[model samples]
Target chain A: MKTLIVVSHPEFQDSITQAFLKTSQAGLDDVTWHCLDEIYGSDPIDIQAERELLNGADRIIFQFPLYWYSAPASLKIWEDDVLSRAYTYASEEGHLKDKELGIVTSVGYPKSAFAAGASQSFSISQIMIPYEALAKQAGMKFMKPLVIAQFGYSTDEEKSQLLVDYQMYLTAKYPFSFNERETWMIQQLKKLASGNMKNHQQELDLIIQELETGQDDLNDLKEQINLIRNKEED
Target chain B: MKTLIVVSHPEFQDSITQAFLKTSQAGLDDVTWHCLDEIYGSDPIDIQAERELLNGADRIIFQFPLYWYSAPASLKIWEDDVLSRAYTYASEEGHLKDKELGIVTSVGYPKSAFAAGASQSFSISQIMIPYEALAKQAGMKFMKPLVIAQFGYSTDEEKSQLLVDYQMYLTAKYPFSFNERETWMIQQLKKLASGNMKNHQQELDLIIQELETGQDDLNDLKEQINLIRNKEED
Candidate 1:
């Protein structure tokens, strides 16, 4: 599916979090990255052009650094000038119907800080009710938010893992569960093994066997969880 | 107290709800009304000047129509340009510390639409977590949001009542409770009775008595509620 990422960071060039995330989606042909500041810096925003970009995408992701628990001013302006005017009531049915609305936001604080008794005192989902409400109003499906917390403190290994996970979140199958990912990996390995790749066939076979075993273990754990829940009910 | 109302409506002149609210506070001294669009119409925001205005205010109110469950884009831009750079980290203690942050917003839908199983499917307070989070980060006291829902359908009587309530919200005591308002009204009546107002002394006295009776009734209701809770525990 074609994906559009509308990035809204005041200092986009200076943001290490955004820069690193951008690198994660590198060489992805189906992804269109549009920076708000670069496109409409200090100028009157072209609403038509923005609507055109929205029309061309199957999935639209609002990517930004969380400023005071919301997007920076640039994104708000874009929403007012472009989205509200064009998408809300301009037509009989809204322009953004059936499209998937997603958010990929990075917060300065750790994820643990956002809880009832924690420093933030509210979960990310609670704070993002405005977006959910907007999605409802526009007839779009609100996808679960992808939250990246404490990007500055992440180790190199974690960053590498994040790159893989972020890519999967953007372009992988819908619902993007662990089961789907495992199945995809196994399919790819089988395809490679079928080819004249005799050098890595043994290693690929071993990895495929490990993945199948892991899936079985996961199913067994799920059954155990269900049994425990039923026991508690009783 | 000096009150700064930073209004972020795109078309303030044409907005009936905002215009009516503005008339409610007409000729009020110590209230600075700054229209964001009129101040910086498609121009680069003057961050220093905006900071100066914020510093002068005892209470800062963000007044706007709730677009997509938050303020209009102009306000967000003002926040990014003015507040974040200057107020958030200019000093060890933030510039907005101890000052009150208030929201005066109007929504298109009825208040009933915002509930668990309702059309909006979330409370206004939930949708306003971003503002609360901002206030917490800035060390400012986040005032209870003054939500005006379905302004287009409100009757003249409702509008008049809103005018009184909205004024009290902006300039009354710190908490702005019903009890404080009752006390303020009684005090005003007593002061008027003390003056050479021979014609309305009896009417004023009756009004003062009614207010006192209303306060007594409210206290009695609270006591009954507490007693019922204790009984339930027993």
Candidate 2:
């Protein structure tokens, strides 16, 4: 599937979180990153061109930092000028039918800050319901939002995990599962081992072994649970 | 209390809903109407001036036509530039503390279209939660939104009612109630009758009479219910 990420940030180059997220998907072939601020610098949006881009993508992701509990102004402008026209076309021509609509947002505050009696008083998911409603109106499937809370303070390990998760979020098939993610990782390691990267062989082997051990541990836990159920029945 | 209305519409002059709503509050002494599109006009926002306007108002109203389940892009841009800076000031100086935040939105579709299993699939209240969240963050009291659904197709009676409601929404004290609204309307009719509006004397008297009749009927119903309970006890 061709995935298009429409990024909206007031100062894209200055955003550390956005920069790190962009680097994670740098080598992907089927993914296209379109930055709104850069594309329409002081110019009116070309609605026809935007519609063409949307037509070519199977999965469309709206990526931004949460500003005032919603997307940046540029994205809203794009929706008003471009997406409004696109919706009209979709209604008549079924252009966006079966397309996947996804949101990948980064928030400055911790996730826990968003809840009843909390600082934000509403979850990120609640704030994002309008987008889900928009997706339904356009006959598109709304994907679960990928929320990165406190992006500026994320550890390297957390970012590494985000790299893998975000890539899968963009390209993985429908109803993505944990098992599919594990399989994909293993396949990637095997491909790397077969290539002429002899210097990294030892590191690759250790990583593969760890994955295998983790899988065995999960299977053992499942067996233990089954045995407990059998004993209870007897 | 001084009320500042920040109106956001891409095509403000061409919008019937916005025009009608604008007329509702015309000639009001303490109300300031700032139309974003007209103020900006392809130019960058003057953040300093916007901040001054926000500081001067006791109640700040965001009035707009719902585009893609949210406000127009201009509003988002305003939030990012002006509001973000104002929030910093609010944190330190408590500038927005004790202020009121209100939303007056016009939707293209009917109110019923926004519900579970409906075309929009999310109520206006749900969609406007972000604004409510923003108010909480800034230490402002969030007012219940004034939603105008299917604005173009509203009946004349509905439009007349909206005119009164919208005015009270802008100027009324905190915890605005039905009784306060009715009292205000009666006072206005009495004032009009006392003024040199001889032609409107009969019409104003008729309206005041109807309002008094409604109030009397409500009081009589309450008294009858109390009497029935006393008889039942006997």
| Candidate closest to the true structure, highest TM-score | 2
Q: How does model 1 fare in lDDT?
A: 0.84
lDDT of each: 0.84, 0.85
Across A94-189, the per-residue lDDT of candidate 2 in tens digits comes to 678889999999987788988898777898789998888878778889898998888778898998888888988888775677666776777667
Candidate 2 yields a Cα-based lDDT of: 0.85
The CAPRI classification for model 1 reads as medium
Q: For model 1, what fraction of the real interface contacts is kept?
A: 0.80
Predicted complexes: DockQ each:
0.63, 0.84
Q: Which ten residues in a row have the lowest lDDT in candidate 1 chain A?
A: A84-93
Question: What ranges in model 2 sit over 4 Å off?
Answer: A85-90, A194-196, A202-234, B85-90, B202-234
Estimate how well candidate 2 is docked, as a DockQ score. 0.84
TM-score of each: 0.84, 0.88
